[model samples]
Target: MAGRGDIGVRIGLSAVIFVLDGPGLSVLTTHAQEVAPGLPFGPFDPTRHRTFELALRAFVTAQTGFRLGFVEQLYTFGDAGRDTPRAAPAGDPARQVSVGYLALTRDALAPPSADARWRPVESFFPWEARRAGRLPLIDEFLAPRLRAWADAEPGERRRRRVEALFALEDDAGWNEAAVLDRYELLYEAGLVAEAARDRPEPPAADDAPLLGQPMESDHRRILATGLGRLRSKLRYRPVLFDLAPETFTLSQLQAAAEAVSGLRLHKQNFRRGVERTGLVAPLGRTTTGTGGRPAELFTARLGAPEDGHAPGLALPALR
Candidate 1:
């Protein structure tokens, strides 16, 4: 292991926390006055902090005032020149290596700081969400542009990738877990701000499509990594309960799944899947505030599982 002095690499921690709200899955974000919103990010202090996760939890709480729960390390970002645009740490000129994390919560806390706020996840990746059905930006704009780029390429690999990731062909289906892949493709095509920032020259077209809102630094890329990890984890883990309330209705549970996956599920089918897994149990209570008949409330049975997997019916493949 390299000591702190061996390599001038400063470790940092960044988190992408998602909360379900009226609009759907929203992320906790922060920024200075008149600056682009970014994930809760801060440098990890080796002296005062014992572990990297502890240091991350402390800074995130101090900055956002939202306590993190069920945080898992997502990835480590260490590309040079990516952290240049942001405020550098005080010390020697060093490479900033950030350990990214993903956390989920049921409540959206008000940021005590004036600069912090909650922004909808779809705002950063407009093309990823499918709750609105067909997206004009994808069908009308992104498809044509990406198709053109794929055709210009010399090999079948690029075309195949575009088709699979973007769901360009009629048979090809969209994969929510491929969030990072999709983002990297957009960056390579010069559709995103990070691509332009990384390249020696600006994108060829002055009218290049600003794919989505950009973060201050490579925070957006880190966010994509978190998003992809969460989506993929839904398949094998019961981590989704971290985003659910202590007690919630079945419809509410379905809504949470839909919000995170960005897919509108068939109510009956979803309920059937949930039942088959025996993941939830009735609370012996019903609420009538749903604007219709009273619906039964259910709570996730965290202890019911014999093996380690919890039934997560959020993704389409689960159905």
Candidate 2:
């Protein structure tokens, strides 16, 4: 066993895989020792793999029986001491540095393993979802606690952050890309389960401060980073098509965008915006499977020059 004097770094890859699940978006999660499930992850073996992505794909398949497609490197999580529990053994003295990636799938396929399953993203980050309507949890549960925490001394700075990231007041609007920022703020305020675990003098878990679930080590943080990256990409790239069927109704397309953004869209406005982009074209067919009215089917112009040059889908959020 290495002593405390022995310092080392281990390279790990965490997969934040997202898939469209009906009207909601879900992430692929697996578990081992943590109270909550975490992203599919494994160590990067320099000797066994030629590239980091190959190693990530290999272990994810090994753990969940799922394969990865296009993935973007989201961030490098090298924060000292934040991942001590999962870095190695209890006192192995080696730090864990994870390279996180974001992946999107057309469907939420089953993982074929009990340990791995599709869990809705909103379940882990309840306050972020706004598709159904206003989240009562925000006003009734989270906001009150956050306000009290901010009201405590050093108030102004804290209060302003709370208002901005969460849109606590009408003057501010929630930034979908601030997912990790919000979580980190909650951590500092000792309002999250992770705070209790990480801070010696933090508000105890008994406080039960609207704990939005906790995953092992820094997995939840990595998940938030991926979510924020994807949400930001929506404004400039039509990458949502990667999570959509080859042919889909405009409504279905809009639903996919809404699921990822965690916001509702004005129906006609969204369709008009998508049509203007020229990223998708009518299939000359219809899908009555939509259950209500027969909706026109359209396929994405994936390789068209116009598509490659086009901007993202237009999302006019309903105020």
- Model 2 CA deviation exceeding 4 Å by range: 1-6, 33-35, 85-90, 204-209, 304-308
Clashing pairs in 1: none
Compute the lDDT of residue 46 as modeled in candidate 2: 95
Estimate candidate 2's alpha-carbon lDDT, on a 0 to 1 scale: 0.84
Q: TM-scores for all candidates?
A: 0.92, 0.93
Instruction: Write candidate 1's Cα lDDT for 1-319 as tens digits.
Output: 8676675777878889988878588889988777678888888777899998898888888887878887888889998776542445545578888889998887776778777799988889999888766567888888888888888889898788888898876666788889999999998888898788778997788465587888877888988998888878776677778888888888888888888887777888877878887878899999897778899989988785777656666454332
Per-residue lDDT tens digits for candidate 2, residues 1-319, read 9686787888888999999988888999998754567788888889999999899899888988898887889999999867553435666556788899999888577888778999999888887898876678888778888888889967499888888888888656668889999989988887777777787675844444446878888888999999999999888888998998888999889989999999988999998888888789898989899899899999998565643564787778875
lDDT of all the models against the reference? Answer: 0.81, 0.84
Q: State in Å the error of residue 213, model 1.
A: 0.9
